[model samples]
Target: MSKPLEQNFVELLEQHQNIVHKVCRLYTNNYDAHNDLFQEITIQLWKAFPKFRGDSKFSTWMYRVGLNTAITLYRKSKRTINTQQFDTVQFKISAEEYDSTEEDQLKLLYNAVHQLNDIEKALVFLYLEDKNYKEISETMGITEVNARVKMNRVKTKLRTILNP
Candidate 1:
């Protein structure tokens, strides 16, 4: 990491911090593990920065990198499962009263998503992020039909969890 590249990466991180944080929170429920994953993703993104071409938008690239980093982290560490299962605290909706209920609903949705597998989490995250089936498929390396099917399955899973 050259000085200028390092500086530029810091700037990039600042600009896209929300995407990384959102992905991290969606992928893991444990605060410590979430922070670790966020750091790991940041490192991975920085390591892979030089290879990034001007082919696609930076955010799209970051999304791909973020998802891949998270999935890879899950694959590499087996401890997160037990830790995640033990800590099931429900996250409160912290927005203003006007939209707080909606925020709480979204929080519950993400909580359910947190219980899902990595691939499933990625699917639900993409869906919530408003990525169409085509883009989700491309980012996830799955077929468009499969993306739609998986997204439908995610919605069904959420409905079951929230309703039951």
Candidate 2:
């Protein structure tokens, strides 16, 4: 990488570190794998950085790339490795106080989402991250209607898992 591009790369990482970390955490529950995937995603982003235009917000573009990398990179294996050694990292939330019930519910939701198929998990990830149908469709290269339908199915599946 050229000096200017290297500086830009570091700046991008500094600005969007959370996005990459979140993708790694969600895609690979194991810390070692998560770190490896994180590195790989960063490399992928750097490689693809040249194609990025300033038309969209940087976070939006980063989300698209990171989500795509997470989904495609980790979809090969279906086995759940033990994550006992992985430390539960805290996220930066605006609230001054933490709600254990809400945290537990979120954990339960992620656990159930973990049980979904690759495609379903992708949809769930985008939905949980508050991505709109259009963005999700663009990222996944599917129709907006398809994104809505998939999200609806994922919600139903999650409800069943959480309730049952």
Give the top-scoring candidate (TM-score).
2
Q: Pairing residues by index, what is the TM-score of model 1?
A: 0.80
Q: Across residues 38-155, which tens digit of lDDT does each residue of candidate 2 receive?
A: 8988988898888888677677778778878877776556565333222275557654565777767767777787777767877777777798899888877799999998899888
What is the number of backbone collisions in each predicted candidate, taken in the order shown? 0, 0
Regions of model 1 farther than 4 Å from truth: 1-4, 80-94, 97-100
lDDT of 1 by residue, 58-114 (tens): 777888899999888778876455324422543344435437677577566656777
Which candidate ranks first by lDDT, i.e. highest? 1
What are the clashing pairs of model 2?
Answer: none
Q: What is the Cα-based lDDT of residue 58 in candidate 2?
A: 73
Report lDDT (CA) for all predictions: 0.79, 0.77
Candidate 1: lDDT over CA atoms?
0.79
Error of 2 at 106 (Å): 1.5
Worst 10 residues of 2 by lDDT: 78-87
